[model samples]
Target: MIGSLLYLTASRPNIMFSVFLCARFQADPKESHLTAVKRIFRYLLGTQGLGIWYPRHSTSFKIVGFSDSDFAGCKVDRKSTSGTCQFIG
Candidate 1:
């Protein structure tokens, strides 16, 4: 199920973080992890019409990117998860 959600992240960036959190527990997921995954699915169902939009014929053609991550954000392991998004015109 996590695999399917990861594939959906390509079009649904909003669920990326939740999916990543659930993915980290794939090796030995507990009941709480299952609940979280189900919640994500519910969210997807409610927001099926949402998606990215790009404007055409922009006078300024440029590309921008941003990324940030917290240090030791994970409680189980002192690991950080970083995310980035890019916009091009």
Candidate 2:
């Protein structure tokens, strides 16, 4: 379930934080974590039309990228978690 949600995050950036929060418990999830996951699914159902959309244009395009990372951000494994976003114009 978590894996599926994570994959969906590529097109649905709004759920990224919530999905990652639930992902932290993949190895030893509890009832509370399950509830949180259910909430995310409910949210998705409520906002079925939400997602990234690009506008149509003609001659030229510009691509921009932004990224950030934190060292040892993970509590369980002390691994870095990084994120990036790209924009086209």
Candidate 3:
């Protein structure tokens, strides 16, 4: 279930934070975790049109990038996790 949600997150950036929080419990998930995960699915069901979109128009090319991190935000273990993505011209 988490795997599917994580996969969808590639295009659904809106759910990134919620999905990442639930992902921490995949190793030993409990009922609460399952409920939280289900909530995400329900959210998706209600907001299926939400996703990344780029206008198909000619424009000056430029580099794009993003960075994210969890500062001691680990749920199971106290480990800082960081994620970054970049698009260079």
Q: Candidates' lDDT values, in order?
A: 0.91, 0.91, 0.86
Residue by residue across 1-89, what tens digits does model 1's lDDT show?
A: 99999999997888899999999999999999999999999999998887656667777877899999888899999898888899886
TM-score for model 3?
Answer: 0.56
Indicate the TM-score of model 1: 0.59
After superposition on all CA atoms, what RMSD does each candidate show versus the true structure?
6.1, 5.6, 6.9
Relative to the true structure, candidate 2 reaches a TM of 0.59
Model 3: weakest 10-residue lDDT segment is 49-58
* Candidate 3 structure quality by residue, lDDT tens digits, 1-89: 88899999888888899999999888998999999998999999999776545556738655698999989898888899999898845
What is the clash count for each candidate, in the order shown?
Answer: 0, 0, 0
TM-scores of the candidates are 0.59, 0.59, 0.56
Name the lDDT value of residue 15 in candidate 3. 87
Clash pairs, candidate 2, are none
The pairs that clash in candidate 1 are none
Candidate 3 residue spans exceeding 4 A from truth:
50-89
Error of 2 at 89 (Å): 11
